[model samples]
Each structure stands twice: as C-alpha cells, then as structure tokens.
Target: MSAFIPLSVPNFGEKEAARAAEAITSGWVSTSGARVGEFEQALADYVGMPRAVASNAGSSALHLAAMACGIRPGQEVIVPTLTFIAAVSPLTRYVGAEPVFIGCDDSWCIDPDAVEDFCANHCTLKEDGLYNNKTGAKVAALEVVHVFGNMADMPRLLDIARKYRLTLIEDATEALGTKYVSGPLSGKFAGTMGDVGCYSFNGNKIITTGAGGMLVSNHPDWAEHAKHLSTQAKSDMLQFFHDEVGYNYRMTNVQACLGLAQLERLEDFIATKIARYNQYKDALDGYHGLRILPFKTEAEGVRANHWFYSLYLGETDLDRDTVIAALQEQDIQTRPVWALIHEQADYPRNEAYHLEKAQDLRAHIVNLPCSTNLSEADCARVIDAVKALV
Candidate 1:
C-alpha cells in the first residue's frame, strides 16, 4: 500500500516541537504562563487586531464572544446554514438564543441580500431600539462566517446589521489570514472587521496549536469583557474571587508555545496551500461533470488562505458519497461538505429563506486533500483520481 493522503493535517517542523519541549522544560506546561501572553500578542499583531484573548478551542472563543455580546434568551441570531455547526452551536448553548438559518451564495458565505430580506420581511423595530420579529421576539445579533476562507460581503452585511440594530459577529475560524483588498476594511483581516471575531488553530487549520482559538475585537470593552468572562468572570485577579459565572476556557502554555512557532511559519503555509490549490485548478480544469468552486479574487480583492480545495460536481448524476468513497478506497482521503446547520435536529424549526444554493452545494460539494505538506505527487494523484471519477 502507498502512503495514505489525508484530507487535511498539521504541518509541524522542528521549531514547533522544540518550543513545546522548551515550555515543558520551563515547568509552565499548564494554561497560565508567559507563553500564553506571548502567543496572544503575536496573533493579535498578525491579524491586525487591537487585542486578542486565547482560549482552549475555537468553539470556546465563539461562546465567549456570544456571551460578551449580550446574547440572551428570547433573542435571535442570523447564521449561515451551510457552515460547520460549531459556528452556531455556541450562540444557542451560551445564550439560549435562537439561530435563524440564512442562505449562502456561490462564495459559500451568507447572502447579504438574503439577510436584508429576512430582516425586512420578518423583523420590526421596537421603541427601545431593538429589532423584534413578526412573532414578537427580538433579533439580537448576526453571526456571519467566512466559509472555507472566502470573505463574506462584510460591507453589505454591516449595512444590514446597522439597519436592524443587530450585533455582528464574524466566525473567521477558517480564515485567520484571509483579507479583502477593497473597502473601508480593505486591508483588514477577516476576524477584525466585525464587532467581535473568532479564529481557530485546530489541527487541520493553516496554523495549529493542537487545539486552540482566539477572540479579537476593535472595541476595548468587548475585548476586556471576553477576557474577564473566559477566565470565569473573576473581578479581582489578585484574589480567588468571582462576581459572576465564567468558564475555564483559557489556552494552555504548551499550546501557546506551539502557536507561537506556527505563527512564525503561517505565511509559508498559506503560500504552499495556495500554490497547491492553483495546481489542482490547472489539473482539473475542463473536466466534464466536475466544477471547482470559484474563488473570487477580482470582486473582493480577497487573498484567501485557500484552507481547503472544494469541488462542486455540477450537472452530474454522480453522487457525492460515491466520489468520497472512491477516493477513500484509493487511500486518498476526501470528504463531503458540512451538513447544512438548519437540517440538524438541534436547531429549532425556523424559517429558511431561499436556501436552494446551500442545499445544492451540500448535496454535491467534496473537499479534496489540501494539507500544506502535500507534495506535487500527492496533488497529481488527487487530480488523477478526481478526473477518473468525472
């Protein structure tokens, strides 16, 4: 048997292991230590955010952001239906808030027009400057995801958020280095544009701290509040005191050591991923019954991290599962796109507005092997397998 090609995996060099070992040798392998502060500062600088707080995982970052944004019971948050459910799960679990599943466009991000339409048709404003839906429930916030490292239309989404007076939270877990070229936030990174943004350093991400995340915000209060809440809302840091409920969501010093090492090599990782993506594009071009999801560089002036290369099987009777299974049989791992969040049994039965595109992508999209360590030979094997299937 040949080497098994993984869908995505961490690329760790000597620097990462050496840093982890140094942290262990220093006897600061636990959560609280200088490595955590150093990692947070480094990440904040890289993402161009004023401040960032590290957490145990990306999901915890999202949960802390939700709580910090004042998400509460009886309020609604607008979220895309076509993302990993982790993006929406925190909103519901942390605040008892309801998630309104919005549709996605070709970019696999939320449709700004759909967001506006949902707000206009279903929601109205109350005297207290809050948005209330036709069902008389308030819509508190909007959580937009930069799906697969593609930049969502933030300018338009911001307009919609302002019109409805909803808090905007960007789920940039998959888009740590992605940025838009033209707009007020043109030079800004994905997670920095919103009221609060979350990033993941999961094993499969472009950068990894084994399992960690960061929450960043332009607002000082929000950043401070998130830090306070993530550390269990202890008002007095010098004493073991707590004023309100909090969580043990802090990232470990060992993970921070890894994060610092990974951050140093992020640009290289992104470059390698993009190069491989272009290779896949060239190799699979003009194949019938197979369409790669178009990455929009011109419209958004976006430089994506190209985290994962996804292909949309267009106009083919071929089933996605069959393609995935075929690749697995060849020891080349591939996976279908995430299940639509609205389709999950956990979410309430909310109104879905024009979710045709999301449904279509869900049924047909497959993610190919896109790790930074993938060599030219691996790319060729993946392209050959895909071409054979098509």
Candidate 2:
C-alpha cells in the first residue's frame, strides 16, 4: 500500500525548527516576550492592517473582535450557516448576541442577497441601529467567513454594511494570502478589506503557528484595546491591577517565533497549494459530475490561497460518505464540508434563512487532501483513486 495521504497538515521545515530553538534559547517563551509583538507587527504589515493582536487561538481573536465591536445582549449578528461554528459561536457564547443564520451562494460563503433581504424586509432601520422586526433585537454586526479560501461577494456585502451601519467582520482564518486581483477591492486582502479581520494558524490552515490567532483592524485603538483585554487588562503589570473584565488570551513567544517562520514562507506555501489544486482539477476533468469546486481566483478577479479544495460529488452516485469511506480504504483522508450550524441541536431555535445551497453543498461536497507539502506523486495517486471510483 502507498503512504497515507492525510488531509491538510502543517508543513514545518528546518526554518521552523531553528525558530523553535531560538525561542527556547531566548528564555522568554511566555506572552511577555518580544517575539509576540514582533509576530503581531509582521502579520499586520502582511495583511495591510494598522495593528494586530496575537491570541492563544483563532476563536480567541474572534471573541475579541465581537467584544471590541460591542455586540451586547440585546443584539443579533448576521452569520453564514455553512461555516465552522467558531465563526458564529463567538458572537453567541462570548457576547450575549443571537445569530441569524444566512445561507451560502455558489461561493460557499454567506449570501449577501439573503442578508440584504433579511435586513430590508424582516428588519427595520432605526435611529441608532438596525433592529430585527420579529425578534426586536438590534442587528449589530455582519460576520463573513471566507470558507475554503474562496472570496465572498465583498462588493455587495460592503454596500449592505454601509447601508445598514453594520460592523463588518472578516473571518479570514482560511484565507490568509487570498487577495482581490480586480474590482474596487483590487489590491485588498481578504481580512484587510473588512473592519476587523481574524486569522488562525491551526495545523490545518494555509500556514500554522502550531496553534495561534491574530486579530487585525485599521482602527488601531481596537487592536490596542483587544491587546489590553487579552493580557488580563494589565493596568499596572508590576502592581497587579485590573480595571475591566479581561482574558488570558495572549499568544506565547514560542508560538510567535514559529508563526514568524511560517509567515515568511506563506507565499511559497500558497503557490504549492495552487499548483496541487490545478493538478487535481485538470486530472479529474469533471467525470461523473465530480469536479473540484473553483475558488474565486484570477478569472474572478481574486487571487485565492486555494487553502482547501472541496470535491463536488453532488450529482455522482459515489456520494459524499461513499467517497470518504473509499478514500479511507486507500489510506487517504477526506471530510464533509461542515454540518449546517442551524441544523445542529444546539442552535435549533436560531433562524436559518434559505440554506438550500448550503444544505446541498453539505450533503454532497467532500474535502480533498490539500497539504502544502503534498507531492506530485501523491496528487496523482489521489486523482487516480477518485477517477477509478467514479
């Protein structure tokens, strides 16, 4: 049997090891080290943001964004149901905000039309904020996730946000290097275009800091405030003083050093991903209704990271589960896109608007192995296996 082709995994090289050793020798492996701030600055400069705050996890950065945006108890945030629960859950679990689930378009991202529809018909534009007519909660924010590294409809979404006075948050965890190639946001990056952009460095993401997250914003004060809140609001570090509620969400120097190494190679990693994606796409050739879903790339006026590729077998008899099981038999790893968050038992009462596309995508889409270091031979093997199954 050939070697197991696992799903997306970190591609740490000698540079990462060298950085790890450096962090160890510095004797400042904790949050207070200089590396943490350096990492934050590097990320901010990379993404064209004024400032960035590093956190222990991606979810922590999201929670900080929600809190910084002032999503209080009596408010609701429009979120996409097709995303990882972390995108919307932070609004619900951390801030006392409700989520009105929106469906995905062909882009597998929050449908801006549905959001506008909800806001126009079901919500009332009031003096201070937009209010949901039925629930009477202030519609405070709009959180959009760049699912599978595909760019969302930022132009229309931006117009909607401006019209409704919504705080637009970009969950750019999966879209680190994705940037617009054309349109009004021509040179803007996925996270940089929005008011607040949250990123993740999980092992499975385009790049890994082992486990860490960064939050960036053009509003430097928000980043500073988030940094203050992350370090337990240390009003007087030497005096052990605390003013408002805070969290222990700071990223350690060890993680930051690793992240710096990863960041340096981000563009190279993205190129690798793009190459493998094209290999799979050309090799598969859409037989039996099986084709890799296209990201909003050059043709669509965007330069996507191609972070993770989703195989569409919706019209194929092999189906999502069947393909997953068959690939597992060959020691290849794959998974379904995501369980619809609204369909989850925890969010039964929450509103999910027109999830027809999202539902169909969830039923038939299977994720393919997209590791940055995936070899040419491994790519061929995956393509061959899928073709044989079809």
Candidate 3:
C-alpha cells in the first residue's frame, strides 16, 4: 500500500518548533506577551493595513468585524453562498444581521454584476442606506471572500459599495498572501482592499498557527476598538472595570510564535503552491471533460496564493461522488466545494439571489490536495490517478 495523501495540512518544521520553544521558555505563552502584538504588526505590514488585531480563531475575527461594521439586528449584509459558512454566519449569528446570499461568476467568487442588479432592481436608495424592498431591511454591508485564493471583482464591487454606501468587508481567510497584480489596486493584498479584511490561520489554510485569525483595516480606530472589544471591553486593566459586553478572543503568544515563523516562509509556500497548480494544469490540459478552474490573474491582475486547486467537473460524465470514492480507494483525498449556505437547514428563510452559478459550481467543483508541502512525485501520482479514473 502507498502512503496516504491527505487533504491540506500544516507545513511546519524546525523554525516553527524553535519559535514555539522560545515562547514557552520565555514564560509568555499566553495572550499577555510581546509576540502577539509583534505578530499582529507583521500581518498588518504584510497586508498593507494600518493596524491588525489577532484573534483566537477566524470566526471570531469575522464576528469582530461584523460588530465593528455596526451590523445591528434586522439589517442585511450581502454575501456569497458558495464559500465557507464561517464567512457569512457571524453577521447573522453574532450581530443579528441577515444575509442576502449572492452567486459566483467565472472567478468562483461573489458576482459583482449580480450584486449591482440586486441593489438596483430589488433595493431602493434611501437617505442613509440601501433598503431591500422585499424584506424592508437596510442593506448595510457586503462581505466578499477571496474564494480559493481567486480574487473577486473588486473594482466593480467597490463601485457598488460606494454607490450604495455599504460597508465593505473582505473575508480573506483562505488568501493571506494573495495580492492584486494589475490596475489601480494592484499590489494590494486580499484582506487589505476592503474596509475590514479577515484572515484565518487554520490547519488547512495557507498559513497555520494551530488555530488563529487576524482582523485588519486602514482605519486605526476600527482596529483599536476591535482590540478593545476582543479583550473583554476592559476600561481599566488594573481595576478590572468593564464598560460594555466583549469577548475573550485574543490569540495566545504560543500561536503567534508559530504564526511568525509561518509568515517568514509565506512567499516560499506561495511559490510552491503556484508551481504545483501550474504542473497540475499542464498535466490535465486537453484531458477530456476535466478542466482545472483558473484563478482570476489576467482579468483581475491577481497574484494568487493558489490556496486550493479546484477541478471543474461540469463537462465530465463521471459522478462527483463516484470519483471522490475512487480517489479515496487510491489513498488520495478529494472533496467537493461548499454546499450553498441558503440551501442549509438553518438558513432556509434567508434570501439567495441569482443562485444559478453558485448552485452549478457547488455540484461540479472538486478540490484536490494542495498542501504547500505536497511533493512533485505525489502531485504526479494524484494527477495520474484522476486520469485513470476518468
């Protein structure tokens, strides 16, 4: 039997071990340490944001961003359904805001055109905000995820936000190193483009800190307030005075130690990811109905981190589940894209607009093994196995 090629996993080694040891030896392994603030600064500088606040998890960062956006009860925030539920759930669950799900386009991200259409046809421009005619809820924000390291149409999305006065939040959990390569916003990283950008450091993500996240923004006050709220809204640290309800969402120094080491090698990891993606694309080229879904590089000028290598199975005759099971038999892990949020039992009452593309993508897209540590020979094995199955 061959070695098991698992899905994405953390790529850590000597540097990570050394840093974690240092954190432990220094006796500052918890939240009260210099490394945590230093890690936040490093992420802020890398993403070109003025400030960043580290959190215990990515979902907490999203929740903090929602609170910072002032997403009060009954308000609406536009989101894409074809992404990890963590990106949309915070708005509804944390801030009591409702989500208006949008569809994905060729970039496999929130379609800017659909968003514009929804705002124009289904909503009314009011005094302070855009109001949905059907639900009569104020459309307060637009949270777009950089799906699989592929950037959404930011130019068009930004224009729509400006016109509608919507607070723009970028759910960049899976795209820490991805940056726009061309046009006015070229060189800007994924989470830095919007009013507030959220990043994840999960085990399967491009970077890992065991489990952590960061919230960044151009506005200093927003970051400061988020930092304040994350620390339990402490008015006076010495006296233990609390002003408002807050969360204990700060990341530990131990996690930050791992994150700092991971950040140092982020560029190298991105290079590996791009090389593997190109190798897979070249190998799969002209192979019947199977096609590798591409990142939005040419159109959006994106320097993609290539988070996940997605196989578009729409044109293929094979059943998605059958292919997955076959791959499992070969000890290679493969999984389909996310189930649309609106279709979930919990969000049955939420509105999803122009969901054709998102629905189609959900049924056809299969994510392949794309860990930064994936070897060339292992990659080739995966490709050959898929080809044989097809």
What tens digits encode model 3's per-residue C-alpha lDDT throughout 148-258? 988888899999999999999999999888888789998889988788989999999999998999999876788888898999999999999999999999999999999
Ranking by lDDT: 3, 2, 1
* TM-score of every model versus the real structure: 0.97, 0.98, 0.98
* Clash pairs for candidate 2: none
| Superposition TM-score, candidate 3 onto the true structure | 0.98
Q: Report, for every candidate in turn, its global Cα lDDT versus the true structure.
A: 0.88, 0.90, 0.91
Q: Any idea what lDDT model 3 has?
A: 0.91
Clash totals, every prediction: 0, 0, 1
- Supply the global lDDT for candidate 2: 0.90
Question: Tens digits of per-residue lDDT for model 2 on 1-390?
Answer: 779999988999899999989989989889988999999999988887777899999999999998887889868999999999888888775788888999999999899989999999999999898999999889999998999888999999989999999999999999999999887788899998778899999889988888899999877788888888999988998899998899999999999999999999999999999999999899875777787888886878999999998888877887689889999999999999889999775787887798899999999888999999999999999999999998
lDDT of 2 at 358: 95
